[model samples]
Target: MSILADVGAFALKLVLILALVGAIVTLVARGARSRGDDQPAPLEIRALHEQLRERAERIRLETASPAQRKALRKTLKRKRKDEDKAPGGQKERPRAFVLDFEGDLRASAVSALREEISALLLVAGSGDEIVLRLESPGGMVHGYGLAASQLARIGKRGIRLTVTVDKVAASGGYMMACVADRIVAAPFAVIGSIGVVMQMPNFHRLLKRKEIDFELLTAGEHKRTLTLFGENSDAARSKALEELEDTHTLFKDFIRDHRPQLDVDTVANGEHWFGTRAAELKLVDELMTSDDYLMQRMETHDLFGVRLRQPRPLMQRLAERVSMAVQRVREAALLRA
Candidate 1:
């Protein structure tokens, strides 16, 4: 009888262990299924849609007095189903929209800008317009030039584009704002500085003093005008200067074609000025903040803050979490051991 009791106890313990393991496996499988369905939408995206809806609902409910609530209910009830649809079965066009560039100058921003332009064109008709709120100290010449090109795409589509500078738009930053149909600015917003520059440091003298020599070979006469460790030549310097001048000329021409009214010579002096001064020089159309422009349009048209789709995968998030958990477990086991 004691032997039989021991056997039963062992069987019960095994069943209990199996049950716990099965529960854990089932939970992991269900969790995996759920995570698979919830594909990660975007990386570093502001939860704008969820936020807007929640905020609006809170405001509607919390601020309403009894009388106001009754009136709101009546109004809401009176709202027709047809009102939700756009005129003539078409989507209702937004009255005014925003194009905000609150990031630093980089190739990534240029890609986002390109996507934003595509989205704008999708929603905005030929008669529609855009207000680009630009703020940047500047960035790489090629990168910002590409970003500027994205803005130009809007104008090419026959859509009027307005640029408002509130913080600053210097060098390549100015290159982008200048492409707008009309440029506006706040009184103190930094504007202008139309120029191009390139810098390369040569440490050949230091290297020679240290008795360290380096050899570089190239096929083209202008393949490498400047080097980090090689001696620089007068001819190379002259060639570099010539190239810079040509690039500056192209920049001036681009501005000239866009704003024919401005004297490229005057604005191309690589000097930045305040908004009021810029307006005097016709660098800006008017002195107005983008906020004012948006507020004025809000009553007449719907406003939207445009942004690019987030680009992150669920697998990445899951892998990161799993790796973190594994590391923690390993660390804890190591501590015990």
Candidate 2:
């Protein structure tokens, strides 16, 4: 064969070998990291599972008393030797439950937190502590009201709930944090925006200039609020103001009720405060990050992050797997190219 042909063949062989190796590595890596039918269970979950298994084994091995042991010995001769020993005789394991609030300070976060808190109650009894790692930028009125109530559940259950804010937990976010028995924030974390706001913009002048008019009809005197077009009546404006005031009052009451020490008038002016300043104003109890708390707690108890099992439909799981496979193929192609 010509030298050029030989070189071309060798190059092709080398490319093939490299491609195969790359594919194998990617496949193995993906397999290792693949989200199992049950969310790629975290280390904490696996630990919990192992602990439960050990506990069951121990219970099976443990005999109630000498009479129970003798009874078992008489009933089952082969089980005598094993009955005296405790199966997997490990020490009583420490238990810690996690309450994670991760996402926008909206209804989704609220719902998830609510479920998490409920689950915590299920696994945690009295004297157990909860570490709530909260990261939110605040959200709508009713949305955060529900979220705050979720945290309140922990308090109602007599669970010592500790909130850690590593990021901004302003407005509604702070509302949720305030319900905690103790609040912790990072030095630079934006902790509080203890107020409420209603935003409205009117385009009446623009519509009138364009020779457009909007006619809104309603039965109740103040049913329809100030609108975006066709001019707003003084009564409608008053109604809108009244609505804002009512919401603001509710917001203030929520804060006052949660943190009684907070001076409502000072913090209810629709202003935000940083971590250190907030601590002074009694918005947050102290400045501490989630990581620090986790590290400190790790020495005593295994930190288990508990989340509700989100049951995905079979079709959705299949679709996700197919999409992931396509992505892997695309990545492989890009690397080869």
Candidate 3:
């Protein structure tokens, strides 16, 4: 089986990744990008309020009967206001800021996530909320550790952070989620794998059969733990395992610090658990999809999604218009593009 294929408890993770993908598509539709508009603003951030309202209207018109549509149009024309009022006739509305993180082996979203977090912190004060719509199956340790540090900045600023995982947030992904004030996962979403793993295919045997020699040189005694083309030594394998166990300890300590209620020893086995089992193990705080969480918050909070986007250059855009159409279509099913 491919290393990426599941053979254990992870097989039980019936991840509703499609829901996460839909939320991400909505996030992109409401993000800081335009379609060939070339506004010269370098970047633009659209308020999700207007986008959501527009989408809602589109949905209503498409799904409602003619008489219902007429009634809806009339209501839209009328001036509307929040029903909740403060003591002095002011509206008491809490703000909800959203950001999306679609992770890969390299944790590619870290840069954009940092910028979005910075932007949100500039205007978001106390009583505000930030939700990260996140999905990642874990990745390189350093990449995710840095990504987790970016989220840590949000906590240091005293902002409430809610990380919603509609799919999988395992390994390094869980490292980032542990820093959140709340973690919400959909049923059957994959979680945990609160440990370290490393693997590589050794081609030394093949090379030997072909009468080829592979040399690996390292100054430090344990710098090169394993090699793809060189024979592996017992000392090297032992060192590699030792390092992984050490990282596992660090991983457990980090989660324990954030979620003291969790019995780290019981769950930190490089084994992923389905969302229901995760909540039972205290790996996630709640069992609900990201869309459900956001919709519930939208009623009282001014729910907005922040995305730090870079505009494509003219030449690149031209080339992309030629090539990216196929690529985009291919990646449509991915959680993020």
Candidate 4:
């Protein structure tokens, strides 16, 4: 009788757990269906000016005396009234739209970036500025190339574009950064690597030792310059090197065309520098963080942050959550061990 009671209790708990999981999954599925394939992702816009003002007001409330706060409120009220009374066109302040691109090896953020730029270009005029806080350590050549082209669109429209890097913007990242009218970086930010690199490991010798065979066939003479599983001939290696040099030359030409002041030959050596050194080398225009530049611009411009939020499928979200949970469990087990 005691054994039977214990088994019954375990079964009850299992049923409850299963029921809870079922409910959660049903809710997630409903959410996914509601945001079906036909619906477009939403555009999220944030008024940086109002956000900064609220933050400052909060700090002032904690640090300032009552009299000081009262005076500040009155000053703000008077300024608002004056602006309200100003002439229609004269009261319009120049706008600054902010976009953030946190890139990976594929420059995947370009998906959202292209959308954000298109939306901004619709309303942004010559008087408006676009501030892109770009952070990328570099990635695939074609991916970053597309991103650089998107930034070029702003310049073509006669709108000012500013790129700010607080961390690293080497290799292909610098490719995108150079398209901006102004490039700003933090004091210690890594900048520049105006060269191309390609590397792969050959397993031909290992396969030979293991008595394995690998074959690659191509119609064109130079179609396959190098291969991982096949023996590489001297001519193939030379051709690969020649291709890399060609890419490097193109990279240098792009930089020279954009920033003619810099001697491209001197700095296109696959080396990176901190922001200050980069400024001296003319790799970057200024040594300032994105935050500082935006704050200063906010004084004269109405700043806004723009983003496009795409919803993921229910299964994808669940899979990501499960992965995170598994990682946490492994970490906890390691700590216990």
Candidate 5:
């Protein structure tokens, strides 16, 4: 009888372990929403008006009476209403929505940007403007291509789209910037690189010396041009360059399609330029930092910031903690070395 009781206890423990694992799996699955699904991706939006109002209150406190401060708080609390009435009872100004994108080689921010675009499209009006604070050094062709397409959604909806680059927006990143109705960059910001580029290390000779073989097979023509392992031919190399040229042509055409005034031939040399040079090349429309643009806009327009992201699941959250731990270990090791 005691042995049977022990067996039942073990079974109960196993059931609880299984239930915990299932819960973690479900939570991760919830975050991976498909584009076709009717359910919107989990989004988080924040309005900067509260902070702005606090600043406004501080500015007025020196001369404002207790009654005036109370009235100011009341007026600021109705933040989302169309617009505040000025002295003559006329509307103050329109609204501006701001979003940020600091991209990686994979353009991973597109997932969050896509959801934000969807949310804004549902309510953005003609007078409303959307500003994207973009900073990227560029990356994979297809990855940034999709990111640019996501930005294009703003212009498609007839909402004014402004892209401000405080640092760099080169190569694949510039592909995205060109889609904006107006492009602004800081004085020293890096821009352009309107061409295609690819580089990879070849290990075929190293494998041959070690008496190892790397085999690759494909069923289509030009399927495996200029591979990392295997003897490459002149024909394969030529094909690769041809493909790059074709991609470059497509990149230039897209820029011209959007900004017809740009001299595509002069700038499509796979070169980068500073903000002032870029403006002269017509690669940018204005030279200004994102912070300055926001401050100037605040005079007549209400500023709001939006950010959307999936709530991290428990195990996923744990994985982040583990990653931080690993980074700390690596830093310690480096310090000792």
Candidate 6:
């Protein structure tokens, strides 16, 4: 009877372990499957006004006296009553939708930017404005070009678009900034690198030295103008230069069309400048950080920070919790040992 009871207990433990393993496997598989879905995540909009007010209230509570806090509350109440009694009965204030784009080499943030913009366009009017706090050192031509085009959509709809750069907006970053109706930057922000650049290291010589052969085949004459593994001819090099020149020309034209006052020739020489110089050169309209600009706007306009967040799948969330639980168990065992 004792042996049978021990066997039963061991079998039950094995069954429970198998069930947990099977559940984890199922969850991991579902998480992987969900990743391939093309549905975009929902946009998350945060009211900057409320956030600022809450922060101020916290500070006041910590430092201000009870009488001061009471007086402030009364002031706010009276102000709200006055607004409610106004001509239109609490007139709607102009809104300023804020977005942040921290770019990478591929401008991956553009995916979220596009979604945020699309959501805003549905509700935003001409009186309302879109403020983009852009930070990028610039990258690929096509990537930033698409990002710039997305910004242009706001203006096309007659909505005001303002871009603020607190750090840098060089090359492709400047490309997107130029699309804004107004460009604001901090005093020491790096701005402007209106140029096209292409570079790659060729292994042809290295392969030759290593006694290795590499072959490249193409159908079109310019299909493979420059390649990593093949010997580059002068013709190919010249063709590549021509392509670069054409892209640069397009970039210049785009900037000129948006900022007619800019001397595209002077600034499009692959040179960057501080915000002070950039303002003088007409590359930027104002020398102000995003924080200052947004705060100023917050007084007269309702500012909302817009973002799109992809929620983790249920299975993914469960997996993460399970991983954390396992980590805790391991730590517990280590401590006991």
Clashing pairs in 1: none
List, residue by residue over 51-150, the lDDT tens digit for candidate 5. 6767766788656888798876666566535344335766646778999999899998888988888889998888899999999989888889999999
lDDT (CA) per prediction: 0.76, 0.73, 0.81, 0.89, 0.84, 0.89
Deviation in angstroms for 90 in model 2? 8.6
Largest TM-score belongs to which candidate? 4
TM-score of predicted structure 3: 0.75
Off by over 4 Å in 3: 1-44, 55-72, 81-92, 311-337
Provide the TM-score for each candidate, comma-separated.
Answer: 0.69, 0.65, 0.75, 0.86, 0.76, 0.82
Residue pairs with colliding backbones in model 3 are none
Total backbone clashes of candidate 1, pairs 3 or more residues apart or in separate chains: 0
Please report, as a residue range, the 10-residue window in candidate 4 with the lowest summed lDDT. Answer: 328-337
Clashing pairs in 6: none
- Candidate 1 error regions (>4 Å): 1-94, 103-107, 311-337
lDDT of 3 by residue, 88-160 (tens): 7675678989888999999977977877787788988888999999999989888999989898888899999
RMSD over all Cα atoms, model 4: 4.5
Pairs of residues clashing in candidate 5: none
Cα lDDT of candidate 5 equals 0.84
CA error at residue 323 for candidate 1, angstroms:
19
Candidate 1 accuracy as lDDT:
0.76
Q: How many collisions per candidate?
A: 0, 1, 0, 0, 0, 0
Residue 164 local lDDT, model 1: 83
